[model samples]
Target: MRADRLVSLVLLLRQRGRLSAATLARELEVSTRTVLRDIEALSAAGVPVYAERGRHGGFALLPGFQTELTGLNHDEALALLVAGSRRGAQVFGLGSALASAMLKVVDALPESYRNTAAGAAQRLLIDPETDLLARRSVAEEVPDTIVAEVRRAVFAGHKLRIRYAAADQAPKWRTVDPIGLVTARDQGYLLATRSGADRTYRLSRISAAQELAEPAQRPERVDLDRAWQERSARFRTGGDQVTVSVRVDPARRAHLVDTALTIGAEEPEVDGWLRLEAVFQDPRHAEWAVWQLATHAEVLAPQWLRASLRERATTLATRYDVPPGESRPSRASAAATSAATRTPDSTAPSK
Candidate 1:
């Protein structure tokens, strides 16, 4: 660990040019004293590390000093630097380690490629916290300690005990043989087996975790990617799914397709509108997807969904409708209208 820290210390100075002991301590998650010691160790090992004394001073490597670890060409190094900028490392509780490793990658690059690659990486952006629509992407929050415990068990091939909170149910403790951890779109899940049955638990829902000392009961080796794919296929197909036929405007077809799980039997109408049968998770899901497109899309079949949408549209129309040159009712007036609509028995105490 100290050797790794010592290498990280050198890489930090090499990448950032100059960094104060305090800054290094914070980055390394150690005390300033430890940073100072690491600096001494690096210098004693023939690294040309020097410190400046004034208030605006920090440790820096001599100019043109870099590690001889370069093998990647310019494009390969750029690809790595760009991938490193992504938020995947944070999903697995290795954000700081990723930073350190990225620093090493930069510091180890050939001087001819380093500056250009690093600058090019800065030009590209990946998965910003918010998108063009100004909608923020919310990542599931998993406690560091809990994730650490779960991660250890997965890698060490040990049974893991977790206080898991499944949807709409109280948290329950269960022991499972670990398979692997998978991250998709910033959400983390543990693929494991409980009592020889396949189980996948969201890392965020793990309120507590403990790695058992006993070895896991499972195959000696497995293909995690294939396993995850199989599980995903089952999940997508096994739900209470509903299929709906719909006609959508050409401009809004993509919008409709995005929310539906599958599309079948598509044909263009004479009026230039497109008709298609789409499958969604359920009726509610279908309603929501079609509703978002408003008049641009219309549900053709599933009479109940059409009625539900009609009722919702009617309610919205009633709420927004007003006579010409007349303003809509205020909150107080609306409240009075609601009160007036109630029968005497409506508010009467229950028997």
Candidate 2:
């Protein structure tokens, strides 16, 4: 560990030119005392490291010094930076560790690759704030303490005693062997088991957690991707899922499947519009999804959903409809009407 730390210290100084002892301590995840000792060790080993004594002083490597670790090509450096920009590593409380590792990676890149790799990464965006419209990716906030505990239990092969709140149920304590942690839609889920029964607890719903000293009770090795898929399939099929028959415009058929819980079947119609049999969580959920493709999608079965959607459409239309004997107001006419309706004393500055 010390060897690696010293090597990192050398590489950091080589790339950064100079960094304070506290800064090095933070980057290395060690105390300032440890940093000083490592500095001494590097200097003793003829690493050409030195510290200036002034107020603006810190550790530095001699000019012209370069680490042998500069081996990553430009493409490799760019790839790593792009992956880092996704912020996936931050989900499990690895934000600092990822940052430290990325610093080392940048330092290890060849000089010719450094600026170009950084520039290329800057030009590329991963999960930008506003994407293809005003839609944004929202990062879920899980308590740092909870995330740290869950991460430790998962990676250390320890059982976790968790107080979890399942849907519509009171919070209860359970001991589960953590299989892995998963992140979706910026939220974290812990996939675990209790007495061979599959259980998943959202990180946001964990009120309390304890990492057990005893080892986990699950299998020796886990294929997390396979486990997640299996759990997802069970959850989807366990409930009273609704099925709907719908006619979708040929151009918008893909959108139907994309928004539904799952596509149960698909058949082409002679009129060119495709008829899709889809499963949704429930009638209400089906209504909500189908409403998005108004005019482009027609729900054929589940009369209750059709009625509900019809009621909503009727209500919306009535709200904006013009009264009898009144001409439809154009934009300019609406603005003039609004101004005329204002209070006579409203010449004061607008609120």
- Estimate every model's Cα lDDT from 0 to 1: 0.83, 0.79
- Name the lDDT value of residue 71 in candidate 1: 43
The number of the candidate with the highest lDDT is 1
lDDT of 2 by residue, 1-351 (tens): 476567677877876778999999988889999999999988888888888888889989989986675444432343354354455555555555455456677776778998788789689877665778888777766767887888789878999999988878999999999998877666678998889888888888898899999999888888888988888888777677889999999888778778777887788999898998989876667888899999998999989888988989976775479777766666577679979997778567766
> How many backbone clashes are present in model 2?
0
**Model 1 poorest ten-residue lDDT run:** 70-79
Model 1 scores a C-alpha lDDT of 0.83
Which residue runs does candidate 1 get wrong by more than 4 Å?
1-6, 20-26, 29-55, 61-85, 110-113, 123-135, 267-270, 310-351
lDDT of 1 by residue, 1-351 (tens): 687678778778777888999999998989999999888988888999999989989999999786864344432343354355356556666665666667767776777998999899899887799998999877887877898898789878999999999977999999999998887888988999999999999999999999999999988889989999999888767778888989999999998888888898999999999999999987778889999999998888989999999989977886768766777787678779989997778768988
TM-score for each candidate, following the candidate numbering: 0.74, 0.67
- For residue 53, what is the lDDT in candidate 2? 81
Judge candidate 2 against the unseen true structure and give its global Cα lDDT, from 0 to 1.
Answer: 0.79
Pairs in steric clash, model 1: none
